[model samples]
Target: MSVPVLRGMRWWDIAPVLDLEYELFPEDAWSPGMFWSELAHARGPQATRHYVVAQDPAEGRIVGYAGLAAAGGLGDVQTIAVARDQWGTGLGARLLTDLLQHATAFECDEVLLEVRVDNTRAQKLYERFGFEPIGFRRGYYQPGNIDALVMRLHVHDAQGTGNHG
Candidate 1:
């Protein structure tokens, strides 16, 4: 497998990113308006927010993407998605590592995220990065009405290993 290249997401990348967002998150997919809103945040007062796209070197198209918002000691993983075809190809891990690196660069003491209750795969990914379940939000998701698991990761410890949990 070719190594995936990571890059800062540009305005032009939003369309393709939105396509994958819909593909990976059919039921709760964010609309174009929402992605635009997030992009604006990425360029606004929250300029520290990191939004990135991952591409397969061979194809040059976006295969995955991730977002993170860092303010002082707190970080939040806004979202993460991988093309359905690349689900188990480790692209998600690459996107996650990039987010964590960005969080660390921003000097974030901890990173937090909310994962759908049924998304154990994502939970495992977060767990692998030192995130632990801290709480739950009842009826956090709409339509299906699934709950959300709130997870947090502390990145201030001395041992800054790449993989923690």
Candidate 2:
């Protein structure tokens, strides 16, 4: 499959994004209102948040979506999800790479995220990108009270030190 192109989210793209979001996160999917709020953050004055959707160029279908929020030199991975059919096809890695690039663009010192304790696949993915578990959040997830592992990835510049600027 051709690599899906990543681009900014638009008003018309919400339906497909919503579909994928619900498909991947059925129990914990964000509401349309929440997506709208994220869009606001993506376009707000601080303008440090990025919301991107991966799409099929031939048919314009959304295959995945991801976002990151940069605040005071920290980039928090707000979310990332890919259609089940597209999982393990490098789509998730590509989306994550894009989000990390966005973090670098914002010059964040580190990136942070919380993953369900049971999501070993996701944890492995994050680990491959240098994220290390530093703490835990009890009952951080909903519907089933899943615990979360707080992870951090420190970014380094050519100097090999934390990139905080």
Candidate 3:
């Protein structure tokens, strides 16, 4: 298999991204309008959002995508998804690393995200990236009534070390 290439997501990538989004999160997939709104803020000098897509070079397909929004010294991970076949391939970590890099570029002091409480795989990935559980949003996910686990990571230490500590 060829290594996937990661690049900034654009308006043209929305169609394939939506397909992967729905495939991965059938119950809570983001609507096209939601993605459009996020993309709208991802450009220009005053942009507050960063979104990226991973493309399979061999097949020219979007295999993963991630987004982040930052403001007021904080960044929030909007979403991250990898195709099932791409799981266990470090695609999730790559996507997350990209987001964190963007958070740092956005001068964020901390980053936050919410994951489905039942999605242990994603939870572990976040933990590996130095995020710590902070709280829970009761019944945060719709349709299924799944709770959400809120997690946070400090982007840097006071001394300017880029360590999550």
Candidate 4:
């Protein structure tokens, strides 16, 4: 299999991204309007959002996508998803690394995210990236009434000398 390529997500990629999004998170997939709103702030010099998609070079299909929003020296991971077949392939890590890099570029001192409490796979991935659980949101995921684990990571400064915290 060819290595997937990672590139800034464009408006045209939403359809495929939504397909993957629904496939991975059928019960809580983001609506088209939500994606549109995120993409709206992804461009321009004053952009506060960064979104990216991973495409299979051989098939030219979107296999993964991730988004981040930064403001007030903080970054929040909006979403991250990888195709079932792509699981255990480090695609999630790559997507997250991209988001963290963008967070640093946005001058964010910390990054935050919420993951389904039942998603141990994703939790382990976040832990591998130095994230630590700080709290939980009860019944955060609707329709299923699943809790969410809130995690945070302290980003290193531009000089890479130490964490921004």
Candidate 5:
């Protein structure tokens, strides 16, 4: 697979994004309405959300996508997914890097995310980015009763670099 280019996700990307979303998280994939709602706040000066799609330039296809929501000096990772075949190709890190950089732009003091307890792969990715396991949400994933591992990453101002940031 070719290296994908990350660009701002648009309303039209919903259909393809949903395809990947359902493929990656069939039991708990986000619906088209959910994505539409997020994109609704993703533009303009008052924007509180940042969403991006990783498009493989050669094929002009969305290979991955991610989103972040910011408010009250805090940022939350809403979602992050990469094509199965693209796993271990560092696309996940690239997508996450985009979100964290945007988090700083939004003046966020910290960022948080939740991963299924069984998703050690995702947990490891977050941990590599200095996300610390803060807590857990019992049965957060519906239809399966899967627990969620909550992780937090404190953000330091751009001018200064912390051990984690």
Candidate 6:
């Protein structure tokens, strides 16, 4: 199985990323304007965010994407989505790895994220990266009213936190 190419996300990639985003999270997909806002803060000397897209070379399409927001020694995993067809391709881990690496770059002391309570797949992935649940947000997800599990990872404790692909 060939790996998708991972690169810094650019504005042109948002359309394709949004397509995958809606497909993966139909109930709570982020609007284009929300993405635009995030990207607006993702560059230059004042940047505090990192976003990326993974494009399948053979398919020439975005198969996955992830983003990180950092400020005041904290990094938040804003989003992570992988095409349904690419579930077992290690793409999700690859994307998360990118975010964690950036968290370290941003001088973060720790990273945090919210995952749906039912998303054991994602929870396991975070556990593998040394994230521990700290709390929960009731009804954090819209439409379905799903609760969110808040997890945190200390940047210094995550294995290979400084490595990037």
lDDT winner: 3
Off by over 4 Å in 2: 157-165
Please write out the lDDT profile of model 3 over residues 39-59, one tens digit for every residue.
999999999999999999999
Position 58, candidate 4: lDDT = 99
RMSD of 5: 2.2
Please give the distance, in angstroms, between residue 86's alpha carbon in candidate 5 and its true position after superposition: 0.3
Give residue 23's error in model 1 in angstroms. Answer: 0.9
**lDDT (C-alpha, whole model) for all candidates:** 0.84, 0.84, 0.92, 0.91, 0.92, 0.92
Steric clash count of candidate 3: 0
Model 2 accuracy (lDDT, Cα): 0.84
lDDT by residue for model 2 (31-130), tens: 8988887888787567878989999887778998998999899999999888877878878778888898888888898999999999898888888787
What candidate 4 gets wrong by more than 4 Å, as runs, is 157-165
Task: Give me the runs in candidate 1 sitting further than 4 Å from their true place.
Answer: 44-46
* Worst lDDT 10-window in candidate 4: 156-165
Better of 2 and 4 by lDDT: 4
Worst-scoring 10-residue span by lDDT in model 1: 156-165
For model 2 the TM-score comes to 0.90
Candidate 5, residue 114: Cα displacement in angstroms equals: 0.5
Quote each prediction's TM-score: 0.89, 0.90, 0.95, 0.94, 0.94, 0.95
What's each prediction's clash count? 0, 0, 0, 0, 0, 0
What's the CA error at residue 118 for candidate 1, in Å? 0.8
In model 2, what are the clashing residue pairs, if there are any? Answer: none
